[model samples]
Target: MSEHQRAMLNHIREVNQHIENLVTDYWKAYSGIDTWQFWLNAVLLIIPLVFLLIYIDRRRVFQILFFGYTIHVLMNYLDITAVLKGLMYHPYSLLPMPQSHLTLDASLIPVAFMLTYQLGYNRRINQYLLAVVIGAVMSFIFGPIVHAIGFLKMYHWMSYWVLFIGDIIEYIIAYWLTSFFFHFYRNDEPTS
Candidate 1:
């Protein structure tokens, strides 16, 4: 490699190591399993999943799962960007050295979105309208509660309104993507 390439590699390695050290220190001081905050995050991660299992429509389970997975993937990407940009962060996590808001991004948020989408689909409710209501609840209600309880922190650049917008956008995208796939599948079905 050229000298410039070698220097860039070294710089990246240094940055990664610095981040890892910070995560380790942060975990020991605030986010470890011994903390109540950790338990709260654990509950946030698991309870929604249990509820989804109990209440999900068995006939449409796969469809809902796909929608939820889309939301989870999109949220993770957005959250990781926010964390890396120093816009927002989780103060406590179910796992040590967590890089992003895994509990919320992977579980609670996705499950909530999934159930709401299912409801909207089954009832023939306007999906965009449902997205707005659920997004508001997540951004205005749940976000504030988590922040108040010291589970989430935000820098001056971030606001709950921005989060609400982000949630709505992701929800819409996931809904469209899921719909597209199912439409394609139905059209591709073999004739008798």
Candidate 2:
């Protein structure tokens, strides 16, 4: 092989070795099953899921499930992006993924929004208002608790307000997308 090719290969190998070391250090520090944080994250991921299974409205099961799924997908996407961009980090994680706080992004946040959507949809209350309230609780209350407990770390210019706004926007996008689909299926024409 050419000398330039050999140099490039050496660089790639060094980078991979560094990544491997990081993974090893991460597992040693955070992945222990005996740790309280791990157990807490595990419960956070599982309890809401069990509750959703037991209490989800059967009458509008499809709509609620789809909406929650959309929220979960977008939340994970945005979370991974934020982590990659160095906006925040989760010190403890239940899974070994690039994005930490899997429980919150994958389950709790989505389930909370799902229940709020159901409440609004069934009771004829304004979903947007309910979402804003949820966002406030998540931002002003839950976020601080999580940070204080050492589960989350915010860096750079990121703060609870960013989470607050992002949570609201995520809910709105998921609600609109799910509603659009419901309308399309029922009326065969898209609604505004």
Candidate 3:
């Protein structure tokens, strides 16, 4: 074989070996799942996501959680219904919760989106405008791509707008609540 072919073969072999190791480690971790570990792992993952928000701004703790919860409750409701209708599914979940993906969808992503909006702009008009753009991208682009990638699976829905509507509605409500709470109560103000 030529020198080029030899190097290509070596690279492919290395990639395959790495993939094998990852799969083995995954199976080992999942071989015997424990009830506590399920929740624990989720807690562990959530800690860092929270830290990201705090790192962005320490004052916004209550605003973040409450706004996130707003999205969480609504999205989880849809998730349960979707699962029952075979409109959505997850192949894996740490928790046996009705909707395993609730943590990210409801708590993390939407919160982050709103936070990013506010962080970049202090005025209401800018925040709302940015939110709509973010929401549309989330619903139209990211949502369908995730569904195609099997992180999300949808059934009985081909319009793609279904996911888009969910994202748009979610961001609107979550952003609205977070914004109102902050404007009226200034929940994000850091305590003395």
In model 2, the worst 10-residue window by lDDT is 19-28
Ranking by TM-score: 1, 2, 3
Model 2: lDDT equals 0.87
How does each model score on TM-score?
Answer: 0.95, 0.87, 0.60
User: For residues 13-51, what per-residue lDDT tens digits would candidate 1 score against the true structure?
Assistant: 999989888888888788887888878888888898899
- Candidate 2 is scored at a TM of 0.87
Off by over 4 Å in 2: 1-17, 188-192
In the order shown, the candidates' Cα RMSDs to the true structure are 1.2, 3.9, 16.9
- In terms of TM-score, which candidate is stronger, 1 or 3? 1
Query: Evaluated with TM-score, which candidate comes out highest?
Result: 1
Ranking by lDDT: 1, 2, 3
The number of residue pairs in model 1 that clash at the backbone is 0
How well does candidate 1 match the true structure in TM-score terms? 0.95
Q: Give a tens-digit lDDT track for model 3, residues 54-118.
A: 56555656766676678767777777788767787754355444345644564456556646555
Q: What is the lDDT of residue 105 in candidate 1?
A: 88
